[model samples]
Target: MTRELDLVVVGSLNVDLTAAVRRHPQPGETVSATALSTSAGGKGANQAVAAARLGARTALVGRVGADAHGEDLLTALRADGVETAHTLRDESESTGTALISVASSGENSIIVSAAANARLSPDDIARARPLLASARVVSVVLEVPVETVCAAARAALESGARLALNLSPVVDLPAEVLAAADPLIVNEHEAREILQRNGSQLPDGEVAHAEALRAIGARSAVVTFGARGSAVAEPGRAERVPGVPTEAVDTTGAGDAFAAAVAWRLSRGDSLPEAARWATRVGARSVQHPGAQPSYPTLQQVLDEPGLPV
Candidate 1:
């Protein structure tokens, strides 16, 4: 029998091409760069690897191309103990790629060439139903087709698994699936864009935004304010958790790290507040390193967090 997974992530998979620059370029301006590098990425894959490395029995259900990039991606996930049995290889499209520029301050700007990631359809979601249904938590990012995301969400809901949705590179979410997300994860910018596009009554502060996020559709919501920390909302109350103080080297995958930590803690039976606290510690640690997957800390490392928030 296939072992049940702690978290099953269904979305995109990609290879990342990155460069370190002094700062982000302004409109119509160019800047010198240093240290070009490549790695396995894509929000879905990043979150899966992060959770797996942290000892979650994690699986990835996404698509890549039938090429070298796809092979490398599989190797990376397997190295981190992420189950890739459900990850598919598409003969029609090339593997996805992301062009990333990281400034010295750890902030990054990314441009994605979606390729095979864009081709992950609802049909693909159906193929992974058993894996999705057996997971304790099913998480997804807005990298693949939105319909595919909805299919995964519906499957998880039907199976009574907790659903965590990250609306990154934000897009309009279907009402049914959006409401099914137990904790709708969005960074501050993504949150604002989603609310505004959906014509949600925009709230003023982080706490209020989190509350508003819950009001919209999510059973619970978390609005992350980078450096400042994050605010979470459940039924009875809402509160803010301060960020772990750190000097960051690169902010790539920080939000993915946060989402994975939340899912991992939830799978371990931690409450929202408790989960957010641990997530903050993990996110802060990610910014101290350079890539997405490489920056993630092990479960033991998180346990040894010196300044983890209470």
Candidate 2:
């Protein structure tokens, strides 16, 4: 029998082409970039790497194209100790790519061409059913088809695995899938957009936003507020956790690190708030470097950094 996985990530994998700019281009405007770099990325792949770096036995379930970029992504994941047994390759489409522009302020804007990621289907999830069943936590992201994410959630639920849904680039998810999310993670903007889409009243504060999300469907909710830390809400409780202070060099992929950390900690039986606290610290560490996967801190790096909690 296959050893149970600590975390299973069902999502997208992409090669990130990043450019450093003085500022983001205005609408329909062109700008010169100072430098350009290439790295492995994709929400699914990033989460798997982040969790593995943090000492979780993680696996990835997604698709890449039959190309060099796809091979590079697989290499990066394997280097980080993530199992890629379920990561497939499609010949019809090119590998997914993300065009990222990082401004001098460390904030970034990204445009993704999903390519083979778009080909991931419910069948992919079904093929990975055994891996999902053996995971303590299964994380799903929205970079792929929503139906595929829903299928992963259902499989996780049926297998009694905790579901951690990172609802970035938010979309309308079914109530059942939302409910399965032990903690549905989203940034402040995403949290508001979700409420707006559901035709619900906007909450006045971040903590309120988390509570509103829990009220909507998620078993719990987390509203990340960048450097301010995150707001966490669960049954009969809601609170904010402050971020660890760090000099951010690049903000890209920090959110993926946060989501991965939360799921990994949850698999270890940490309470939702405690997990979010640790996740916040991990996120802070990621910003101290450049790129997505390259910037993620290992467990030692995170623990070595000056922080209240280990």
Candidate 3:
């Protein structure tokens, strides 16, 4: 069948509970939050919404609990123009949730309860074969089981689509898994994790970190460096994409938005450097707002920004 989606995301979905605090409390101390709110989030959901808002035909394949949160998440994705028909509802578990606390400095601490997200099986991925076959690019995150991620990646490769994997949560993923991805995105910390796991220490700098990532199996690696911008590395070259000058209000989903924009651009046949530029713009846009999915920008919003090549 012809591709039905420009991008397909397979991973977790969560209800995010956010609080703004003056500062993070020290050990054994407590602090009061200044504001609180709830929104739909999860790396998978956020990226799917990000791609859809940026004009990609997107589909999400994952599981959520048969609860109000799940219903709300599905509705939100649909409203964002993402296809959720492949999303399954599990009655045995509640929807996943993340408790996020943001400090005045725009730094955040988060605790996630995987809930239904952790229960996703390879069967769920198998059920999404058609959708995977119909996508030009398939993205997966670490929130789901490794087997599920691998299955999705392998399927996408077999179907002649690109496989993009986000090595989030900074865990020790199997080497085979890394080898399967066409392009893998990770933050600076995650790059350190992979190097540490391989019995190596990355030098304390973006340039060094980018070099180490290429030493690993990623055909290409994109490392997001927060305020310092981001670095992109292919087999023979690496370059830093300058970040937009913006005062961040919340940094929670900035990386996810960046990854989504990069994947969207790649699906549209943009080169890695071009995609990284788009991702930087998207990341900058995300921090200007406060929440995860709520903070993502539409294609028009990104295009409206000055100096962006569109």
Please list the C-alpha lDDT of all candidates, in the order they appear. Answer: 0.90, 0.93, 0.88
Extract clashing residue pairs from model 3. none
Per-residue lDDT for 166-233 in model 2, tens only?
A: 99889998999998888999999999899998888887988999999998989999999999999999
- TM-score, candidate number 3: 0.97
Query: Candidate 1 on 105-167: residue-level lDDT in tens?
Result: 889999999999998988888888898888999999998988888888998988889999998
TM-score of each: 0.97, 0.98, 0.97
* Number of the predicted model whose TM-score against the real structure is largest: 2
By lDDT, is 1 or 3 better?
1
Quote the lDDT for 66 in model 1. 98
Worst 10 residues of 3 by lDDT: 205-214
Query: Candidate 3: global Cα-lDDT?
Result: 0.88
Sort by lDDT, top down from the best: 2, 1, 3
Alpha-carbon lDDT of model 1: 0.90
Q: Model 3, 210-283: lDDT tens per residue?
A: 76776777778888888788888787778888888989999988988998998899999998878999999989
